[model samples]
Structures are given as C-alpha cells and as structure tokens.
Target: MRKWFGQSLRLGLAPDGLALVRTSIWPHERARLLAQARFKENNVEAALREAERMLADHEREGWALRVVLSDELVRLWQVAPPPGAARMADLEAACALRYRALFGASPAGWQVRADWSATRPFLASAVPQALLAQLQQAAAGSGFRLVEVAPQFVAALNQHRSMRRPGAWFGVVHGGVLSVAAFDGALLAAVRTAPIPEGADRDWLEGHVAREALRVGLGRPERLQVCGPAPKAWASSAGRLKFACTLFEDELDPLWPDSARLAMTGRAP
Candidate 1:
C-alpha cells in the first residue's frame, strides 16, 4: 500500500522572525505551535540557526517540514508559457526567462518554483538558494525532513481558493506587508505586494487596491478576500474595496510576533 499521509510541520518565515507549527496528519489535521524565534539581525541565516537550537531536543524522526516564506524573501511574478509549448521543460524555461527579464539577474542564485502550465499563465517564485540550503540544514539537523517550501501568498490561496469567487481579489497580510493576487474572472492576472504603512486605515486599503488595479490594467473587482493580520477598525467595510477579512489560526495568529519571542529555546506558552 502507498503511504499517502503522515506527520507534517510548517515553518513560517517572515522578515523579522520565524514560526514553527507542527501538524498531525495521519489521524486528522491538528496543529500546535512548536517553536518560534526572532532573528537578531532579521536574516534567514540567523533565524535558521535559532530554529535549529529550538528543535535540538525535540524528537521528530519521521516528520516532514513545509516552509512558508514571506513574499519579501522571494521574487514573485507571472509566467506565460510560450506558444506551442508542450513539455515541462518548456514551462520551466519560460519561467526562468521571465525571472531574468523581471529581476535583471540570473536565476542561478535563486531556486525557481512555479505551478507549471502550458495553456495558461501561472505564478512563478524564486527564493535565494543560500536561504534554502540553510532551511534544509536546519530540518536535517533537527531530525526532520524538509519536504516543501512555498510562498505564504501562494499557500494561502491554495488553502482558501474554494472560498474565492470569479473576479474576486485575494490578499494575504503578514509582517506589515500585503501580498495581492489579482484575478481577471477565474484566471489570475497579476501578483503584487506593498508594505502597510503605519496609521493607515480603511481608506488606505481602498486606495491601494485602486492603484494596483490601475497598475495591472484590470477592472476593479466587485469583491475582495483578505486573510492574515488585518487592522480591526477596517472591519466596518464601507470603502471602495470593502470585504470581510479572515484570520487563519484566529487565536494564535494575532500573537505571531509575540509567539516568536515567547516560544524560544523550546519553550511553549
């Protein structure tokens, strides 16, 4: 028989800190915050070293790790497969070429990953290879397996995609940055991110959406869906882009930064 489901751990990497969530997948999906740490210099290498120490005493021999990286750590863009493209290589080559054109740098230093497609446009992401190697080393040193690494924006979309409707915009906010995946009807058109400035309110959200819509040259959506740490005052949605925001991991999520500070050195609070 094929082994389909097993243990899994989620490592959330942000600009300032990191969060580790372990999930039991065999019986049912139950997640518990394992350990979270803040980087001394807000660097992935520093964060990874801290993470290794946190998991030094934990025993997870057969568990797999899923890393969710913040958008700032990655260069994200849309890739359209060239006409007459048929093989997987064609799609990958297209992504690589697009990456070079957009970032003006070779992808050799970055690990390019994407939802490969030949018929429609797909999102592509490139992460620093050195950061990836550190993440892999941390997992191996902790006696866990590093299975997958993905951008938090993409991961959020995959999780709540069924809730999204045609032409609706989706956003994920984390670490004071908002990552948007704009869709023209059912097809994703553009991906962009901007930092959420301090003291901004509901009107700021609307203005930002309007600017992004114009930037992408797409009509404004009639609906929007947002997930992550959103301002509470924006709950009363009477603005141009008003929508109910959903916070995943409602209880533990709000305390994300604090969780990282408090749950250090293998201590859970």
Candidate 2:
C-alpha cells in the first residue's frame, strides 16, 4: 500500500488555453508539491475554481483535503514582463538564483514541479520570455522555499518510477489538462505532454501520445493506466489513436476516500 495519497488538481485558465494542475499528498508528507499554478493565460478566477472544485470533491469524500494554492499566489497575479532582453544565459542565471533562493531557504528542502501551455504565438521575438519570467518571478516570491521546478511530465514520470512498477506502463492525469504519463518503469527515461490544441481532434491527442511513445522506445505501451477519472470522450478519442494497450483500473489515493467520509459525516467542511 502507498504511504500517502497524491491528488492533483488541474484548472482550465481561459477559453482554449492551457490547463494547470496542482498535486499534493497527505500524511503531512515532507516531499510535497508546492503551491504554484502554471499557465500562460491570465485567469485567476479559473485557477481558483479549479482548486476549489478539487478540494470540494476531496472534502465531500472525507479525504484530508490539504488544499494548497500557488506558493507565489500574489506574484502570479501580477503577470508582468521582464525588464530587459533576457537571453538564455540571462534566463538561466536568473533561474539558478531564484531556484537557490526558494529551495535553499525551505526547511523541508522541497521543490516545485511545473509545466505550461500557451495558445498564442510569438510571445516574445524569440521564445515567450514573459511566461518564463513570470514563472521565475513567482518562484522568487516563494521565499526560496521551493528547490526545483520540473516539467509536470517529468514529475509524473518520477512519481511513477518511485512506484517501481515493471512493464511498459501508461498513466493518465485528468483534471484541467488531460495528461498522459507513459514509462518503461525501471529507467524512467521519458515523460511528455503537449497541450491539447484548440479544435484538437482525437487524432491530435493520439499523435501527441504516439510521439512520446516513440521517444520512450515504445512501439506501444503494453498497458495503460489512468489517474483520476477521465471523461468518456477523452477515452474514446484515445482509443481511436492506437490499437495497443488496454486501459486498466486505477486506485485513487486513500486520502480522497477519507475526505469524502469527513464531508459525509458532516464533521469537517
């Protein structure tokens, strides 16, 4: 049995933009997900709604319901551009300083994992510096309490690797963004998610998965596992993409059930 329950909350920030997901586990786990909502869009209401909805679901289920908002909640709201031309070197130096400050200062030495999707093109003359700057600025605001900022796909892959399950495995995270995590299990070589583009047909999503599958040396996963409950349409769309891998039953973390119990008992809200 798992020692802690990890429930990820994903939010759809704006109309046809990327989604953000916050993950946390219980038992007062020290290795916790930081409170940082990552997205390219400007929509705090959507972010709040996503978090609140997940908490409500957990609470109703009597799970512990440890809700964490963005660690840099206030800073993220500002959403400003960087002051000067931030070359990659400048960006890397800035990120290193920011990461050191946040993660080094944290008593728990915890880190933040993040990934983002943007619908708009040409955010900067080069790549979008605004979003990266905002993310860095947000991390800087966390009082150096977060150590690392990883892509969400990498986070999911690492988490699954920790489980040490063997086989060509496939996992899905469903909330604001529908993410797929596939691994060879032992090596933890690759985990990837591209934004579900606007007017994304099932073929598009499948193509994304297929690309990742190829990247990870999979002609196709032997089996697929889903985390959280996925919508019927998503499943159907994914099904059409490939003739490989059977979807398997997923066990939610026990904390969700506990949260539900507490809500039903009317003992905790």
TM-scores of all predicted structures: 0.83, 0.35
Model 2 TM-score, 2 decimals = 0.35
Which pairs clash inside model 1?
A: none
For candidate 2, the 10 contiguous residues with the lowest summed lDDT are 117-126
Q: What global local distance difference test value does model 1 have? A: 0.72
- When summed lDDT is taken over every stretch of 10 residues in candidate 1, the lowest stretch is 260-269
Q: After superposition, which runs of candidate 1 have C-alpha atoms over 4 Å from their true positions?
A: 1-8, 25-30, 236-253, 258-269
lDDT of each: 0.72, 0.36
lDDT of 2 by residue, 223-265 (tens): 4544333333445433453633333333333434221211111
For model 1, residues 1-269, the per-residue Cα lDDT tens digits are 13525556677776678777766544454457777766666676676676677666564776776777777788889998899999998898888888888888789988888888898889888889998888888789878888788777777777777878666788877777788898888877989889999987877877888899999999877666776767765554454344443333343444557323222211111
Model 2 bad stretches (over 4 Å): 1-65, 68-166, 197-202, 216-218, 229-269
- Determine the C-alpha RMSD for candidate 1 after optimal superposition of all C-alphas: 5.1
CA lDDT of 29 in candidate 2?
34
